[model samples]
Target chain A: MAIDAVIPFKPKNPKTRLSCVMEQEERETFARAMLADVIAASCEGGCSPRLLCTAPYLHPTAEVCVDADGLNESLNRVLSAASSPLLIIMGDLPLADGAAIRRLVSTEADMGIVPGRGGGTNAIFLRHPGRFRADYYGASFLKHMAIADEAGLSVEVIDSFRLHTDVDEKEDLVEVLIHGRGEARRCLQSLGFVLSVEGGRVGVERRTHKETL
Target chain B: MAIDAVIPFKPKNPKTRLSCVMEQEERETFARAMLADVIAASCEGGCSPRLLCTAPYLHPTAEVCVDADGLNESLNRVLSAASSPLLIIMGDLPLADGAAIRRLVSTEADMGIVPGRGGGTNAIFLRHPGRFRADYYGASFLKHMAIADEAGLSVEVIDSFRLHTDVDEKEDLVEVLIHGRGEARRCLQSLGFVLSVEGGRVGVERRTHKETL
Candidate 1:
């Protein structure tokens, strides 16, 4: 099935721990690369979801949402803009990659809603494919899930590591950096982050999936 | 405001993992110590609106559910067994401790539901006192939330690291052990269970909470 991947951009508070400390150049590089990774991962997983984008720097994305409306509006914009199956995402999310979206899209449910650990919808999909106005994604994930259930939509919350962690605070930056320490450890070294003994002692793990696509 | 903690016992697998690695005596010691930790911590937390009791160990918790019938049975047990506000807990949970329950019980809410990730409900409190018959546990957090909402009960999901990670698998074990590391690290440690990784390179920045208790 073809998908129109939607990323909603809601500005973050500078004081908000999740604000990006990376400069403009780094941010752009990260964004472009991240988008590319999502696209490539989707392709590898056999999902051909198109990108319906909205954010700080709109590139040659499928389309950039002009109004900086809140999350629901931005999500509805891209979801409404396309008639194809789609996965709506949080643009600020740096951890979610193609694999996560693939799993989410591949999930066999009438409506696939990826609820953030905190209250909010990280990524949502409509097997029916249309502009269904779901006014959620606020203070709570529980609230968001409740709204989905009331709409009579069949919802499934898939357990995916990448999908689970959305970079939202200063500490998130550290978490991701520490996770980078695989054979990719030098990547963190290059990025100028430190790995406390805590990082190694705590360790990291990812789940296995039945091959996607 | 008071807690009568109920631990529903349903063990999915044998205690082989904990028993196999450690000495037989050590395994028993570990279980007893763990139980003591829960009791002592609960006392220290000074939260339990009432009392904490364990259902006679019988079924695998995964088998014992919190659906309508199960919830009704548990609530009936709570009503008959407890004289104070009741907070329901699953006995299979090796990680949940007193500090977490205290936080759940002591926190002010007309009614409360401690949610587990991926549509599972951990613990719930009813202000009506000994009047709960809602079955919720395993994979039914959302259902219980709706039930509470329908009853016009104020429902809250308290943000506590100690409570969030439920041990259902090997990865969950890693996550449970890594709790109390703060929000960012807690989330990242969950990532580690799914894959092998190194020290640094990627960053998962969470907006740090001022963490007001």
Candidate 2:
């Protein structure tokens, strides 16, 4: 089975939700980092994906095909073209790791579901890639599972930290800062993400619930 | 007893993260709307927060002074002066419901931690008001809990969807679009975050695993 790595690049205006927290450059930087992560994972796997769909407007890169269609259309177009096993990843998932992707692709099951921490679908894979279509985000994890059941496809929910977090807002970035350690560390201190722990304590303590509540 | 409500107001900038997906003015407008959500929540509680901390400045209506200490320092000033109960709500936690706040406060726990589906604290209420001095974002959830323990105070993790899912990215906006049936329902749809799932599923569905792993 061929493992085709796909990152859904939604070039929607970054201002959509919690994205108001960082600058555009930072957001772009975040995307660049995610792409780097995908590249790194691909390198570890030592297998170049068959196709990569992104914005047609961006500069050409190795194995990346700029999908001229708008965000969702591009994703759907790529989803329709999968001839082998397909691994659909979110471009916003900075925490995605190579090991997780390899594990998911290596699975015996015909389908894969990786849930975002907030009940959204972070990453999904399918043996019959082109035929799979459903709501991309939101609480779509369970929905996809149900569809697989109806389709009679064996499904697997790969438990992974890398597949669980995707950054699209400021707080999501904060989550990266909090959870990412070592190389994957969000480099919060360098990125100027705020954290004020004085020797790991607030230092100010008082007791008064009756007074306020 | 002072209940200082900490909110971060984002200034209009082309560099802000939201700008990546939206125009600068659009980003600011979105940020303000989130601030309004907090303001509304505080109003429902019948107690105005002592301070409204914005990025690089404090609100004109606020008493505490925050001269751009970044998010960390601003929260520090408020937490330091919080001799009474302190309600620290994210500006983007639009789904945070008044009932959830009431329940959290009613518990009268030493540290009220409303963990986001992503594992971060969404709405945190300190009964001692000034007992927590740890960082605000990232892994600080677990870190702050440790801090409370070190300070000889109790810490309770309260699970509330309203308090946990703060909007920071586009996918979060999609979450609001999918599950906006709650308090922020109209607000979500009105903001142009519409994704017609066409009624398939709300979240991730299928799971494919490697047989070897």
Candidate 3:
């Protein structure tokens, strides 16, 4: 059976919550950089994923399949159209390496769900793509698990900290900087990113250097 | 009915998890600053209980009573010694203000349990201090709740994000830098702490200034 990968990319106004700390342009830039890293990791894991973008945009590293709908609908469309086994991965996991992806897809179960931090469904591999619909609502990992159980499909629970820690909050960026060595890290470094220690805890701080006249 | 706030502080090895990002001297300084802020907030809420420390150290603002023991034992000692109502508050809650403290102590229950983010007992207000002991181990919130239940005491669960977000990990520094505007923030600022954005998220970064010839 052929197995394909599907990555949902939201390039337009991505990481809006991060706008509390990053400007619009910077947020978009950082989001694309993370997407690039995710794409690279997926490719290295031996699965050329169909990049499903929310809006039409040029991905320098991967091909785009625009789906101008919400997350569940967009993902459902891709799964519905698929004729073989598929792996769905979120495009924000900066620490998603080849080994992690391989471990996730190498599961024996017909359906595998990777739980994210804070009750999110980070990645899922399905042998019957058309049979299962995507549900990305609150506490989605449990919901997806229930879905597989109700469907009477063998489900494997894939729990990896690196795969689970998807970049969502401002604090999450600290993890990326600490553990990540990819396009996202390079993008942050180019934008003058550095680690800051506050209240005996570590965080990220940006420094802009100006030429002295 | 006097409400006293007993803040358990470990100044020697405060926030050791943050050792991944902060130096020993820096951690000590920052921990003390956070403790000072917690003390000020507690005092403003009309509770000027003794600051319990594991080691003998002079606090610039709050009076320190050295316990020279571990957490549960030292706290039990203080609870046993106390004759009236006492509130135990952790020293690392940088976002804790007077209002949150007032809310916590104002509860009508005989025993109040304030929960931390990751299954920690952040603060507890005991109307009958001598009647109950504290269990501040892993997942101590549930243990404290069980203790209250077994004692047949009226338990009030005080849920406050400000009180819950303790400065335990590196990412926790983000909460302090974003929402905190007290001694802890000032201490970090004095040590060249600033905000940085990477991967569309916020973090704290330090920038040291050097003198040139």
lDDT of 2 by residue, A16-36 (tens): 454555456655555655656
Q: What is the TM-score of each candidate against the true structure?
A: 0.44, 0.46, 0.52
Model 3: per-residue Cα lDDT over A123-179, one tens digit each: 999988888889886557667888788888899765354576688777777767755
Write one digit per residue (lDDT tens) for candidate 1, span A1-213.
456565544322222332345554444444454454444545555555344333354455345545556556666565566666766665544445455577778888867766553434556777764535656533334555666677677777654435555555444444445322222233333445442234212222221232211
Interface RMSD of each: 14.5, 9.8, 11.8
Q: Is candidate 1 or candidate 3 better by TM-score?
A: 3
Candidate 2 Cα errors over 4 Å, as ranges: A11-15, A45-54, A57-61, A70-72, A181-189, A197-213, B1-213
How far residue B112's Cα lies from its native spot in candidate 1, in Å, is 35
Candidate numbers, best lDDT first, in rank order: 3, 2, 1
TM-score of chain B of 1: 0.59
Q: What is the lDDT of residue B116 in candidate 3?
A: 65
- Candidate 3 local lDDT, B29-83, one digit each (tens): 9998898888888987778857888888887766679988888999999899989
Best by DockQ: 2
Query: For model 1, how does the per-residue alpha-carbon lDDT over B56-100 read when each residue is reduced to its tens digit?
Result: 332222122232234456556665655667666643344455656
In model 3, how large is the Cα lDDT of residue A147? 79
User: How close to the true structure is residue A81 of candidate 1, measured as C-alpha lDDT?
Assistant: 67
Listed models, DockQ each: 0.03, 0.05, 0.02
Local distance difference test, candidate 1: 0.48
